[model samples]
Target: MAERPKNDHPIRSPDIALPFCFFCMMNEPDPVLRTLKITEYFKEMPTRDDRESVLALSGLWSIAMTRPNNPEFPEIGIFECMAKLICRGISDREWLLRDQNVYIPYYAAHIIGSYVMNRAEFAEIAVESGVIPPLMELLKGKISWVEQRVAVRALGHLASHEKTFESVAEIGGGVVELAMEISSIFVENVYRQFFCLKQRLKYQRNLLTRGLGGVEIENRKAEEWAIQTQCWSLHLLNCFARKERHLNLLCKRDFLKNLCQIWGGLMIPEAPGGIGLLKTLCKTEPGRKMVADLEQVLKSLCVLARSSDERQVMAIECLLSLIKDPETRHRVLEISVLSLVDLVELENGSELKKPKLGNTLTQALLQDYHKIKYGNQKLHSERAKRALEEIWELKVEKKRREKLMSEKEMKKRKLLVGILKKQGNHKFRNGEIEKAAMKYTEALNICIPKMRKQRLVLYSNRAQCFLLLRNPESAISDTTRALCLSKQGSPHSRSLWRRSQAYDMMGLAKESLMDCLLFACCRIKLKHNIPCYAARMISKQANATSVFGCVKVRTFEETKSLLENRQWGNMTIGGC
Candidate 1:
């Protein structure tokens, strides 16, 4: 099991438990104990062993120095103390010292001040000693006001260092996710910290690195300084990311996910690196490994392609560059052909997401199709249309396969229902839920009396379709039939849980509660199982009335509270 990051320390040794080290309990009035009286404990370090003891002493002293305004130990950077530990013939506990929060003050100092004193060596040492990850964590952390100011200041200086660039480049593609998530937090506030961190970063380093990009700057200039500083910050960010994954890790196909998330402000407009760098990263081996799915990457790339702005043009240029490769270009042509047909059938302006590059890509391919089908090869290509089958395969058909496979003994005679199930599934995953329901109903209509298991699955599938279409009565009736036909150990138990969810969704709480209890008691014996737990937790009811007009029981916040405390099974009379 992974160790939690909680600040609990190991048991202490008896020797170090004396007056000096155990300063909180000391009464001998020694000088070391006198200084340590401030901090409550030395974080319980084990120093009985000779080697670990020296490290423990170092860690204790380091922890004591955490507070900057303590007015005892002067502000010395961690690199200085690092040299002290190495030179003191002290045991190897550099990691222990780095792990302590006391060095946070020193870490913040290094980020801001290292460049000021031409301290490239110090920066290199930290980078080599595996300190960059934690430092980057500090940069993106929910730090105190002073800590934030210090961290940004330090990162600004370090950004200009050649060593900084090399280390960041080598931070590996594996760290892409953590980097993206943490860096994304600063997209808004970074504008505020940019200037302070930038000029305060390394001027000499920037001087050497800032090559001819047809952009010139007078560092000492006062007007619109924020703009200049932001450019530099974006540059440093892009420079770091240019090597890692792309402009931001957000654009990586495997890196990001299509989970439930708020749509707005997801784009980092301040960093124009997304379409440009990543369009290249996708073709590279490192970039390829970083992405789990190439097709998914292409779809994500489509989001950027939808941009009408100048960078979108650049992004198109990048895409066009990729198309020059026969395989990649062939893939784009195929995917876009089907995607175009999918879009035109829908209402105009259905897409609000700007990064919907797929739309423009469709247009581009349709025009190309006109050029080829009429002017060149006359290719009314079914293969291109077949690419939609993959999208349908991955996203849409998941439900159908899941539903059909739920049975232990499904009848071979009812195989046509599986086909319609796939059609219904594709329709639903493609955001055509009503059509999907129609498909499911047609499938259910075809299920023979001989195929009871198939009928149960079709009814259950249709109930889901009803819920998705917001038709509560039809959904409830279908689910009722499904529950009755489904055997105790049949695959229909899943249908039981889904019925409860559908009932919960329809605000028919009496029906919801009945199925919820049935699932909780019969199907899932455990409280924390996903379906039962979520049915009871996520579904809401009126403050004072259930669907049957009885007293409303648990609220959303109460459920959330139980979830936070891991006390979900604590449901009881009057305490819900």
Candidate 2:
């Protein structure tokens, strides 16, 4: 056969998706359109080359769409399946994953990590399938180190999951080793942004109530979780430690010292972090008594130059995340502060109204500062200056509202959002339709812009809110909008399922069942959920009207029996 002419635009650019993007999945309530688009992607993309990338990116769009504000989980399941098929095909093809051709697997890993970060259903699938182990197999051989880095990254993601943590541990997983080998290539500072935000938000509430500022008990539950998560992470460091043995050369000692100190700080809280020798002394106190006894160990930071100390960076970060908690930080400062210059000094200055007692780190700072000034040990002079600048900046901001908003206002926002959500949920719980609508609308008035998802959900709740509020037209419009942007807006059984409910609300029975079959089959495929579909249609098919409207399907005994046999929750399905 003659060679086919190659179009100049061989690989499709990322912009191809901009034209037909269905982020309308957020507000899309149409079951047929959603499913058809997905089918079109799989069926109509001209080349095998572009199809997978397009499919993978489409999956990325759904990540935010499926969050709690919108519970269209089934759409996520659908796109994840699509993403997997594309990635699986790439993994199966060896030539496709090589050097000049590495973008394939690189993008694959990017997709895997994106989904992994989102904690998509695919995460559970990735763990159960030992796919992480097999993907780690790519770490060897002559493929691009960048591709290898991606494989290691996926492992890092798996390593983060609590369920997969021990399972990976049982095998001395290769992910750590691979990551250690290539730590130089990856930057992880922003990866923990969301986790950090949630922690700060929790503490911000505490500051409001006590009229006390600063993260109290920062070492407790919040920091504890970060610490406990580290055993697996620290062990992954063995991967880096085993290679390029001189981590000390490139990476800073304070950096590595901070790493060990985080875990060590957790073990012995009477120490300061960011600079705590006493905490290190006590935690490593088997035969060592004085701080000098562990100088060799403290020197581990200098040795991290080879494997590129990311594990160390992450470990220390896990600890720093908790320093906002007072009890944990207090204990940490007492035992481990290397000098009198604790982070508090950098944060609050020496002359705050009432100064804190923990300052051993101040002393250590003096000593280390002297040693580096005198050239006793190797140092990243520029990094040290930057660290000092940070300290000076902290001193200025210590007593200031770190998060800016006043305690009362922050509390009001948090309180109002949480309470409003609960009230609306409660109204629905009690089957008080009118009350729920009022509650959600009231909440809507108080909501702010950054809380866009909540706004989206508030609008959704309002649709249901309106239904109970007895405003069907507004209800239909709100729900229709919510479904469009929701994850289920994609072609999947779930969008169909939600649409079924919406059409039923609008009194459009036939239109409701049109995709009802698709949704029903989807549920049945999952085994036990089969009854939901049948229940939706139970005894309702007898109507002769082809028109779409909420036609009450007669079900006196049919529903009564459904109530009796399915271990009924005493919940009545009214006007079926």
Candidate 3:
């Protein structure tokens, strides 16, 4: 196998400051010896002497994160030490280590994940150090979702390497099965237990607050982490699915049905969620057959394909993949035709800009559909022509009518549009929001597209009404249109604010946060709490993107009792 590519820039762990300062106090100046001393101190330290072990683990975690490519740390048995601490934390319930022991498994697993992330050789050494079994124990929920987060991360790194993948696969189909379950149903419980609950653990408070904020910040951080846990599990599942291992386990009908619903939210745009795994499955025969058999899955993809969500491209790709295979093409063709047709003209559509892939894929799909449905006939099928006409007729007729209008009649239409706007504003003040929205729609219909400034006002006004009606999706679309018609960089601030609010109502924190920031930037001076609110969301996002940010806060007592009472019995790895 070729060598794993390196990360040119490694992520510096945010928790490194205090640990690095502590390491600076050491008399030994050699970095390798310093690392070895730390590892040996952690490995040989007796249980219950908690402070030094915590310090040691922190130092090692920093080293692993900041300098993972250095082989000296792994050669000194750091991975083995991490495995030992993890196992002891799981099986041994020492009273002295109780308060601090809850943190050990998380740090140990994080250290292993960080070190093995970019280097296959390091991953191989990690597998050799017996990290997988202990990591599997954590993956099986020996403690809590926090430990499971890092454990899955570590296993994902191990599974990515050609040499180390077999070691992880050797753990059995249970790993894939558990990953599928986490990807599907574990986020709600994780969110409720750590984030929504009023009682906060000390570690949880430390991670969320970090001496800077309050309950709101903590809640946002918890929500981001909850979503991230699912994202990381999907990453692990993708590793196996990418190579077609455990297809029998990964391609479950219920899992695929649920996977279509997991979009990973707009918060972490990098994570494709369930559609990502489905795309991988569609690459193989059994996987494609399974996905093609689920009409509900196809319907979900059709809905997502028509959405403005970032994952729309992934949805389209899955549909295109389904259509590529002759065997599966017929099964998906009828369901996919209308959705694909909506995209074919987007490249040349009235919108200022759109995804180029949509036009290319849809045109290809339409041609293929025509050939399949009409068999080499040059004549368009009635259904195909009707679909195309439905898409283009109104826009074409509008242009043609405007071109034929006399100057006298055009001036009358503009006058009527202005009168309609005033009436809409009057209705809005009189508490007739629906009537106000209807007035704006009528004004917009009469308002020509060339009258962009007029159309902008109409769209923005309608967006406010949609917001009041609790239809955020429509509000987002209207504000988007208004923003497009406004100035390029500094669009209308009201439209930005409305769109931000709409995104927030849709549970899209990052999108809302971005629009909020942009809205502030558009104005010279801010008069509202948007800046403060944006700052809070920024803090939450910072925590969300941190290397080990998703680790749940398990109290020492809870961790100890849970680990002690946990029993393997005859269970296989990841069977829990």
Candidate 4:
């Protein structure tokens, strides 16, 4: 509130001045404009001191452009510029800058990788720009790990697109050889680390014996780089192996043995990438032959099949592919693979355990084993045929037992329903109509529709309870169900009569008359004295008038009067 000390300057509010100052401080160049300017500077091929700055700027641009929501890079021609940079060979002047020549291609590869990481369109563009040949050359050359890594990653991104994938296979010759070379380097590095560690432990033991503290054995930096290189090389090989020709080339170089050695020796922790490459190679006939030629490949695969890891699934798949070839199948049989298959088939105490193991085995090896074993009639036809017949008989017996058990269970349920129905009848006679209805409902709940006689009786009994409870609608519903259930003899006639009574109570005169006529016709067809017997039953019931009123013939006099008046002319009693 006090006057500000502003001498010659105009008095300014602190709030306004603070915001203005903040705005001035926060002013920065737009990232897109800066990226364009940097890209232009890089294209000028600046001096040696400016080269590192250009690479740093381009690296930042590459990272920023990799974001999904960022604007399209090709709009500014940056993608084309980067592609041209990658495709251009290293100039003699550039090669003179010690290791600076490597950085140029590395940064270009990095920018290309960022562009095509998740974008298939950009990948196709990269392939069409002819960047893959340089990248493959980088992989083939003796280069720094940083340059090789970047090149391999770029090729991998480009290979994800189908168009680019075909180009990689066609243009990128020696890619398999490169991968195998890297794999050998990785294996050698791993063995060196192992021997080094063994020696270090022994030295540490001697030092401890001499009362000096043991030394910490640090892992070599080269081993870490080798592992990363191994993974990327394997990924690239797997990509190329999608084509059969590349796969065949890979197989010719003892590739299966190398992969088996790594996987079986536990050289790398979970080499699923290598295993995946092996699986791709094994898909071809020549590849399978190469795998079969390896000394311990099949044995290692059999051991791997017993593991529970996802890698084991890939191993099993490779084994299955190998067993499809007749030569390889005979080789597998000679190796006594049946012993390994037998482990899965052994009858464990738990029924579920055996089948689950058997399913994995059958899906992978045993199914193919049986196919190969039985298809050759000249080798062991009689023995194979006998085994097949025994298996078939066992399957049939298993099915028969299942069917008999089902029938037994069904009979037991029906027996339970019968007992419930007897209890319901006892309750009904005791005049507990609601309790009797409840019991009948319980019986109906468990009663199967296939038991027509039982279901019909349950419906009829429940309908009687509904009538006693004065629920004529529900009574009609139950009786209708009973009639539909069994349409023969006494049951049908009884259901019809019960429904007629329900209709009469509901004051449905026409429907009641129709049902009564149908019931009388049914009784007449049975050669029973229909009208006399019906009248006797009606007389025994006090509420018979409501049931017979629709016919207008409750008494003999009424019947005679109807006959004389010809009121029955339109109704046919026997033709229901």
Best by lDDT: 3
TM-score sort, best first? 3, 4, 2, 1
TM-score of 1: 0.31
Can you write out model 4's per-residue Cα lDDT over 430-500, one digit (the tens) per residue? 99999999999999776654676897889889999999999986776667557645542343777667776
TM-score of 3: 0.65
Off by over 4 Å in 2: 1-29, 32-102, 118-122, 129-131, 138-142, 184-357, 360-576
TM-score of each: 0.31, 0.33, 0.65, 0.49
In candidate 3, which residue pairs get closer than 3 Å at backbone N, Cα or C atoms, i.e. clash? 146-552
Q: Residue 319: error of model 1 in Å? A: 2.5
Rank the candidate models, highest lDDT first. Answer: 3, 4, 1, 2
lDDT of all predictions? 0.42, 0.40, 0.70, 0.55
Specify the highest-TM-score model's number: 3
**Candidate 2 lowest-lDDT run of ten:** 301-310
In candidate 2, what are the lDDT values of residues 129-224, reduced to their tens digit? 445644455444123333444455455555556565555455553444443333321222111211222223221122122223344443233333
The stretch of ten residues in a row with the least summed lDDT in candidate 3 is: 3-12
Task: Sum up the clashes in candidate 2.
Answer: 70
